[model samples]
Target: MAKYLIKSDATIKAAKPKPAPYRLFDGDGLYLLIRPDGKKWWRLDYTIAGKRKTISIGVYPSTGLSLARDKAKGARALVAANTDPSDARKAAKVKQAEANEAERRVAEGIPLENSFEAVARAWYAKKSSSWVPSHGDKIIRRLERDLFPWLGARPIGEIKPPEILAAVRRIEARGAIETAHRALTNCGQVFRFAVAEGHIESDPTRDLRGALEPVKGGHMAAITEPAKVAELLRAIDAYRGSLIVRCALQLAPLVFVRPGELRKAEWAHIDLDAKEWRFTVTKTDTGHIVPLAPRAVEILREVQALTGRGRYVFPSARTSERPMSDNAILAAMRRMGIAKEEMTGHGFRAMARTILDEVLHFDAHLIEHQLAHAVKDPNGRAYNRTAHLEQRHLMMRLWAGYLETIKAGANVVPLHGRAAA
Candidate 1:
């Protein structure tokens, strides 16, 4: 019997020096406990495993005798029904907390204010999970500077094709037709990423295929003429800037990779001792192998002595953590008096593409493999290139010899445009 309820006018009792368990009004089935030294607490009298169990509900007076009595009755019910009230209560609270958190996130997220720019960072973190590190910064930066400013905060679900089209119109308006197209692509990718992550219901940029204006210009010309190329190489050898400029000049002609690919070269990707460069991930956003040409090896070896300690091979001169400015090599060429008509940084790929096909007579697949084209294997699957090393090794040596001979101005002639011919 427990004296949980003290009837009016019941004689008030003083606790002895030693702690004793007391019951609320006789037979009330609730208990109050005082410790051996007057410390107090409430305990629910119960039974478990066929043995008596006393679960602490709370302290009396603080919890108050009435609350302790009610709590005791609840625990006693669990004992009678063969359940644990404490465990049940904890599980119930946990479930309620989870529900509350979900509700909070929903309450905070209005598809409008939680716009593309606002949530891009968290979205990028999710997107970058499977992406290679170098590509993460490139794609995100392009979006932040180009797309987010215009369309980021609009409720992604509410974003219409025309609304997206209008955003891209601003990019084209800035003389960035190619950039506008790329911005559209990026916009589509982000929305898709958002949709996949449950941030939005649909991608709005999908319908704007030809909505952005087309580029008016043609491809830049590559310089391969012995006299012109030699003049350019001669100028690069003397111009004063980062030693990386000289190294890039050598690697650019020898490897003939795109400017973007060359800039993101990471140490883990290149193995100079093995005379091979393995981009565990390639410029096409796929895995690629680069068989280091002798000149390519030599150039890397030199650049290594200067910047081996850094992450990017051609780290931006302005900032060690950044890649070399996309315009660094072209600017150097311009400084050496080479007009945009005479050559461009990207022109090196065209030069190699032409010479490797016409003069050297290399297989197109082998050439494309070296150039890191999005070449595919038999089932129309993305080709994982074992970069035609044996053939490339031979071709690269020959190409280096050919360039040297060109630099010496032997058997050299200026090129005429294909239409001119």
Candidate 2:
């Protein structure tokens, strides 16, 4: 039993290829295999559990005689411990791969794939496309600010309802009862997503019903009184801000669409000739048609002269590629000395809902339909976009005329259901 038989580098290099594969033994189950293709490979032959096995150590010159011997020594040690050298090598490779994956995830600020944060992020990425940008932003921000800090690192499957309640309690403690409820709802959506993806057994949020404080008076402040509404309209008409923002403010009450929808209005969706603004309502994922009143069309036409060729009807001042900031109209109102307690961008909806029903005396269903709400029919089916097109068009025209009369400081009396055409 000669040991280190092919010792020197010179002898190893001198060993030429053979007609068939042949080995040069170096004792202790280590050998150099020379093939007919003129390639040399280091191999280790060992027996584990009375079964013979061979594993590759390295190649010829690059591995060198010394390095191959070191690798062989390690393999032999594993074999002595009743482990198969080939199996040990495979297990080590797998362990190294797992370590690399973890390191990469950490570097990217991504939690473990099965963690609550990771699954929630995955859900957000999947669903946010259908949501308005502001709404999507709120969901991710809520998760990061309220829930991620506490439960993000925990495995999604191991999280219980109590842990979720504890995280939402922090949001409640800050007096954001509405936001706390919203955070809980968002978490439920994420958990249900996890359940569908097989990351968790069930949604834990379903277990914690009625656990938080009820939201007290979450309505946006609005001026529903006719006199105050007239003053607001006059102020909006005289807004000394950018023409684009002023138009948005003036149109807000007339059309009464959501602020996000107004700012993100695209030129492609507006048809002045048809006197309609068509867009997908992101909240309900439904197609919506806003039959532009004569006044609303006039406002759009005036702004169209400035932004006709762009993607957005009212683009951001800094860049035309995007819409105006969500805060643009609100900021303009604040600049005009309208406090948040007095009015907000969203307050227009409440204002219109009240005025259209109270003073104008329009059909409640038509008002709700015009508001793009989920108005159902007699059979419990939801009304389509153009359910009462003729009446709505007439209603919008009258509503615009009424606003003009009030803004002129005319003493206007309520139509009291006489205005519905």
Candidate 3:
């Protein structure tokens, strides 16, 4: 305890700096400490368990004489209770810092709801770089159309399984059973992302197993029979549309690539001298190499004469600035009297997979690689785009000649199982 002396604001303002550090006591353990540098600090001296300790209350003007006395009175109370006032002050500072951080985050418009749409957009922005442009667009579009309307503003941490199911049931109600499943899968991904990012404690979608209607596992419509394959080839030859569409139809079964990959093929990705078409496949975002058969190269050369100066090999008949519509081949199929149930643009992939594996008797792995399907190596690693290049080149030539023979009405067997050779 000390006698009360310093009190008035005028005395604090008039106090001069000393040659050494000095203190002006108010009462109890409270005092105003002055240094030779002219800075004034309010300090509290206290004892707990008979040990002396000092703590800064604040500064003069910032903490006036009256306020400093009041702080010292509070410190004396804590010390009487066997608690360290310095420790209490530190705790208060920590709480204040936390409050300040939360306020700053709120001011920044950071989502306080941690809503499903908010977290999903963050995840997509982080992940979209790896996806093909159209693939990224499709993902965000799925969220915008399906999930955002219902749960975009709800706090994701509070969302339960039934809420997610209700959202998906809306998709299923429209007979989009497959789309419902896909939407659920996307929701699961977002929920998992939130869990990983610590935005939520758990994913509500984990327990949604068997919640959606079982989707019918149906293959894309394709003509795998040799007679039917020949008839489809004749129909393609007879298709009297744009030359670009005809050439695309002619090359589709030979390359057996996905429709998007074929239509979006850039001229820069093709090198006739190398007899290779190299580009990243949109579906898997992995490199793919299509070995150009002699006939395929011929078609490329003919098309290049027209579209060589542009970006896409098959620049749209409507605009050279863009790739042809994805439905170009499908529309051609329709015009050729091929019903939707009979075939589709994607049917070429199915046809090639069936005929190459069963009829041509090629190695299943090689066929899978040619189809740009994910095929793992002996070490259980996936083969890169150019995997089995020489073998694939040989297979492409043989496949082209096989299609030519079929078109000529030649009855062919599996060449005595000689595909591997």
Clashes of each: 7, 0, 0
TM-score of each: 0.60, 0.72, 0.73
Give per-residue CA lDDT, model 1, range 1-421, as digits (tens).
Answer: 4334554222214544354554443233445565666656666655577766566777644676557667778777876688877677788898898667656755885333356765666677776867756668777877777777777766566678887788878878988787788778877877888788787888877677777667754447668655677777677777787799878877888877778778778887898878877774433466666777677788898899988999989998888798888788888888878788768888888888888777656667777777877776667876567645677777767777778777777884432332110
* lDDT of predicted model 3: 0.87
In candidate 2 the C-alpha lDDT for residue 399 amounts to 87
**Candidate 3: segments with Cα more than 4 A from true spot:** 2-113, 217-219, 415-418
Q: lDDT for each of the candidates?
A: 0.71, 0.89, 0.87
**Which candidate number maximizes lDDT?**
2
Top candidate when judged by TM-score against the true structure = 3
Worst 10 residues of 2 by lDDT: 412-421
For model 3, residues 313-389, the per-residue Cα lDDT tens digits are 99898999999998898998998999888888888889988888888888899998988889998899988877778
Question: In angstroms, how far off is 57's CA in candidate 2?
Answer: 27
Q: Report the candidate with higher lDDT, 1 versus 2.
A: 2
Identify the runs in model 1 with alpha carbons over 4 angstroms from their true place.
Answer: 1-122, 128-150, 194-202, 217-221, 224-227, 240-242, 260-274, 282-286, 300-327, 340-342, 412-421
